[model samples]
Target: MALGPASVKNEGTKEFDFTARDFERVRSLIYRRAGIALADSKQEMVYSRLARRLRATGIRSFQQYLDQLESHADSPEWEAFTNALTTNLTAFFREAHHFPILAEHARKKGGPLTVWCSASSTGEEPYSIAITLCEAFNSLTPPVQIIATDIDTNVLNTAAHGVYPFERVEKLEPERLRKFFLKGRGEQEGLVRVRPELRQLITFKQLNLLEGGWPVQGPFDAIFCRNVMIYFDKPTQGKILSRFAPLMKPDALLFAGHSENFLYVSNAFKLRGKTVYELNQGGAPVRPANPGKLEKML
Candidate 1:
């Protein structure tokens, strides 16, 4: 039967059939594809986005549409399915404190530096890192590169464009804002783009944290995987941590979400402070019982 524009609810029930089984299926598919384990509570969100597709295609039930999706792997509907479910909440310098710490580490190291923004949603975090580097080292004599990655292809494309609303640029200081961003004009009013210099410093790509054999080379000096791990299960978190440990330099720094802690994950790194970890090089490692005692060196 052809589906109408109105949302479909199952017989003798308040919840849509799509709301029941499809939600769980979508959640499983997301975890399998992107390693993001969504809570069962997000069923409504899944229903809402998928229901839009149903209306657009005039499909009556989620079951019929899901069958079509499975059969037509190359369809645009499949692509939309992936895009709609991913979260893309990010801001330039969302956590301002991390940038200064990163700057200090880069300046202290004083040579070729490679920084990875592992969960760089829409490119804000990595660009912030690049700006901090530019501010720290007045000259670009020493080579530095920022690698920004996200699992969502839609956001990666947006990030590579480097265009954002003017409001997003307002977070920067006036001088830095003028220096780093170009105000959109004429047809592009209300949008701003990162200057070529800052944009050039970042390499954006699509990467799934759950997948094996990372596409980019590492031995990175620092990595910012902030606010991304809260969606993962502990086992997945542990696996990701183990994978990152070998990719980092001996004294490399790892930064995680404020809500995340690595104490139970692994002993590969010593806690330096809240959500900050220092790779245990040759020195004796000291594990702090509480994050409070660890100094914020930056």
Candidate 2:
């Protein structure tokens, strides 16, 4: 007799009775709520993360916990469930090449500019944008606005605080260190905080892309949706990319992750440079690139 999904069970000696069905249920729920398609190989990972939720909610089995969640569509626990499964991986200037492209675009635009960092994850990416523009325009305050958003509320709270361990920025150049952050002292030792000016340039909020209502308005100069679409399936990626189309200006630039090739996903954009994209003009005799991709002004 061959084994089936329902017949499989987690190996012996566990705190909770986790089975293949329990994992499948989790996969389905998270996929519906967040558009994340968890793989069968992620069974161990899923059990580990949600095991704490089971303890906190005082549920004996995964079945009971999931039953509770499905029973109440509006339950606050849904937020916790979503947050537990979401992954946030980020760093300052993560794909270093994109920043130079951004700085140049901002200079050419030469006016009040707006950019969106759709996956704001713990805030480093948006702050990096602020820092780039500040150096580009030679002002602590620049004529720019950045709206940074992410699905994970837990990370947003940390991002809003603007405090981080010193080790996080130690690798940054000495000039960048002095110019942009204040070293923590006394009781806050070993911590560094982003300068107030950078924080002022950003507005952080909770956003779920899978949901219908997006709270942002844009015909933005640039939009950074880097490294986020890898979590969603192809159909979901296409839907999100189509929505991003109407939100972009005719000449707007889109920055994507190095490993992400969106050419297959939508025709609204085309490759401009490595991992960087711009709106497709459909051969309509668009404006020249010299005005848009100019040499540094400072």
Candidate 3:
């Protein structure tokens, strides 16, 4: 997903002639393609983000653009359509608490650990996991493998490259900067590249969570599927979580977003900590948060 400018108006002045029907069509298409439950409040946000696509395609209006999308269902533009609408706002250690648990798991599991970062927005979370694993093993080459997948093809391309602005890493300690990243020079100045050690440990791919079957082979020790669930309705969330359970080891941990409370959505997982969950056996206590009911998501 593209995290475009905050301003809703084109050139900070001209507003796209968006209509209620246009918003409804776009919302329906996005839900069908990406399983994102865009709220009615996001109408303006939808217009702002997709306005660029309209300009690029030389389409006069959202209605026509949407008509084109529906007519050409298999076109490459379909991917771009989903990419523009989905949210990709993420950063390194956005949920800092989850890393320590991952580290602890790495220590306990000893050699050859596997993890899946289910929402690899521009690759920060997976890289952070790689760094943690490297630190745990005290080597650039750790006995860990990470698979980072995201629905957005555009972001996957960026994540695969493993390059970012220097400011993105400015918060890290100097020692870590030196150990895990290479400072770019000359034309590439003010940029940092994740070291080959870290990059090699991760396999980045594009994956839509709503797909019928996944290409990944897993009994992963942990899965970081945070933030993305907020866009899904309760039933969709529950179905996805059910699919995750079989792919994960019985003792595997699941890390969720701050706002997500899966206790009411599914019975398969028990809350282990703040936004952390593990597969429930039989008598785990019930603790459901007041996760609001699913809106007309589909």
Candidate 4:
């Protein structure tokens, strides 16, 4: 009996035969396609997320879906495959302390400040960067330029749309709400839109960090790559950090995720603050953190 789409059991809760080999194939493919390292623990997550792909293609098993993926590496399904597997947990002002440091940097750097929010999941992080710039410069049209990039095309589309549920921005100060977002009304109620002025300051693009070349120039004042390195192994993280280091000025800052510690991974930066690092000569000491948890993530 040949494995084909007809063999699929699309009934809800139907168990697909997901084997260890299937998991390893997916792990390797995602790493090659986008430089994300899936841990051994992510097996269930991998199955749960890509099971939808199986259903979508009417393919019964993980092996069939992965086979389809390998056969059509350039297909739209490949994009969907990468998107489905990529994690995207983000919010406005998440890791709020970073923004204050960002605001201060923008103020000191003066006009036309450049920033890159490398993991701009669901648009909030880049939009927050834009809002911080607006407040720092005190203008509806702030003198700042931001490039927001993400590996997942799905989230990039959402970021470009710049719409969010009402509750997403409710925690923001009323002043910021009035200044940067338009409350949707009538048919569009219960949602908010990022003000055009704020949107203008940002450019959202789809980029894979492991790509040989980026489409944008650098020498940026700051780069917010938070919460992303936790998904990669130390060597992969170090390679990414090395690439990021050159794009920034010597005084530039790199904001890392809460659980990430780059000290042992990359010697290009020194610890400046909690989860913050400044690019300097080399070999800067890392701040104290729970080494056990950090090692696991690294």
Candidate 5:
């Protein structure tokens, strides 16, 4: 007789039972720890990644897997949790319009301007920032510093390596392709790496935006936190923005994802343009002192 779905069993009569409740538990745990809210639609993805862990550990059920994750003292499961949860989609100069504006800002500032590429997936955005700064201040006295960060350590490692496949860099202009990148050769052919001079300007680190006490020493001239807030809900988004404001210099430029709207969030930042806001430290227009009062104004 053939086994039915519920009757299927393997390895000491333990049957695999993946349930919605189990999915909710894992999803909530991820959110509580990392602030990444997984949609109910991602249940299959959650099951697939977590199921691997279950098989590896010889565990039979989701509850047992959770128990192991909670009690395991030295396991790297926490890192795996973060890696599975965070979205890492990015590309070289993905948002092309932002670069020219960044270059213009660097030129106008004309000093040691610091730029932070928060959520710099796969290193493209930060390197793009570095390249623009180099082009803008080619002969200028001081140099720009680019600090790139992401929550996913896996991607940060890749970003720090600075090597990418040739197709990944297809959008780059030929002149830029020649000037800023070293084309890989021999066993590494068809690959490209950011040249040492450009790579020297950027420092990559892992950062979780929701975590308290950011390691960054800021007052950065411009913060390119683009395309990152889409995963967070309104309250979390507002909280993150408020924390970021105090760390910026007065009149520092803050860039957000194209899809994000700060209207419902903190009013401490003044709208400069589409997806760009200026944090008012002293002379610029200030939002209400109370966050509740600011919400009314919004």
Candidate 6:
């Protein structure tokens, strides 16, 4: 999910000729493929990101590259194109306030906690959820299961490994850093790996919310969909929320990005707190409970 100002990279040395028609064609393709609505402000940014694809495939121009795509409906380049424009900006305990409420919700449930980090990027957000549950339950191996998912397979690959540079974790409180992560040593210095306990609590997968069917099964206690909806238009956001409503437990909470508000999108959810939503009583039709085994994920 892209945020804030559009990029201002110098366009003078661009290797490929990226025309307005090419840009519009790209906007249309990505919208239908991934439900992303590229703003006119993102033209410079689009050119910069997709240029690498042109280079990678040895295509000489944006027109030729897009032509290859229009010709082959199932080209692997579609995946690469979607990944290129997808922006993943996340940090551990990002939008930090959401964790405390999630912990308290788990406490009230009084059973094993199940969470879905629907936009987890590079493992940080879901790992943060795991750590919060561990602290709330006062054990590293608390009865918790987390499924971390993202549309970008590239980010999911990094997340599945549970590794990061030291800077990524340095701001975390010292005790949390010690308990939840293994700082690299010797040849691996300056890199950190999430403690295996935390890693085991999560299963990483690629999921497109717009896709017809989701592999996920739930009555999940919580769903963290922060920062993701901003990329989608109102209708796309509403459709995803409608799908999410059924998988959620009646009391389940939906944590959104600081910049997002779901109230207008669907009646299924109502704001419970700052950027947090819970099912509107009778606002959604839920699926039957199917509490599946977490071991299947491992």
Task: Put down candidate 1 lDDT per residue, 1-298, tens digits, no spaces.
Answer: 1223333344555334664556556666666666676664565677777778788888888888888887786787765776777777888888777878888998899868998899888888888888889888875333788889887788888888999999998867998888888999999999999988887888898787887878778899999989887777666676788788888988789998877887766666778877899876664443323322111110
Name the candidate, 3 or 5, with the larger TM-score value.
3
Q: Stretches of candidate 1 above 4 Å error?
A: 1-16, 55-59, 69-79, 140-142, 281-298
**Per-prediction TM-score to the true structure, in the order listed:** 0.84, 0.91, 0.90, 0.89, 0.86, 0.90
Q: Could you tell me how far off, in angstroms, the CA of residue 74 lies in candidate 5 after the best superposition? A: 7.2
Q: Model 4, stretches more than 4 Å misplaced?
A: 1-13, 282-298
- Residue 248 CA displacement from its true place in model 5, Å: 0.8
- In candidate 4, how many clashes are counted? 0
Candidate 2: pairs in clash: none
Tens-digit lDDT track for model 6 on 87-151? 89999988899889988987877668889999887889999999999999989999998999888
Q: Which ten residues in a row have the lowest lDDT in candidate 3?
A: 1-10
lDDT per residue for candidate 4 within 1-298, as digits (tens), equals: 1223323233456478876677768877987787677766666677788888888889888887888889986789988898998889988999898899988988898888899899898999999989988889988787789999998998999899999999999999998898889999999999999999888889999888888998778999888889888877666777788788889988888998998888877778888999999886755543333323222231
Q: Which regions of candidate 5 fall more than 4 Å away from where they truly are? A: 1-16, 56-58, 72-75, 139-142, 281-298
lDDT value, residue 105 of candidate 4? 84
Worst 10 residues of 6 by lDDT: 289-298
Q: What overall lDDT goes with each candidate model? A: 0.77, 0.85, 0.85, 0.82, 0.76, 0.85
Model 1: per-residue Cα lDDT at residue 53: 78
The sequence of per-residue lDDT tens digits that candidate 5 reaches over residues 113-162 is 88888899889888888888888988322388788988888898999999
Q: Candidate 4: lDDT of 43?
A: 66
Candidate 2's displacement at residue 165, Å, is: 0.9
Model 2: per-residue Cα lDDT at residue 178? 99
Q: Give the clashing pairs for model 4.
A: none
Candidate 6 global CA lDDT score: 0.85
Better of 1 and 5 by lDDT: 1
By TM-score, the best candidate is 2
Task: Evaluate model 1: give its TM-score.
Answer: 0.84
Error of model 3, residue 132, in angstroms: 0.6
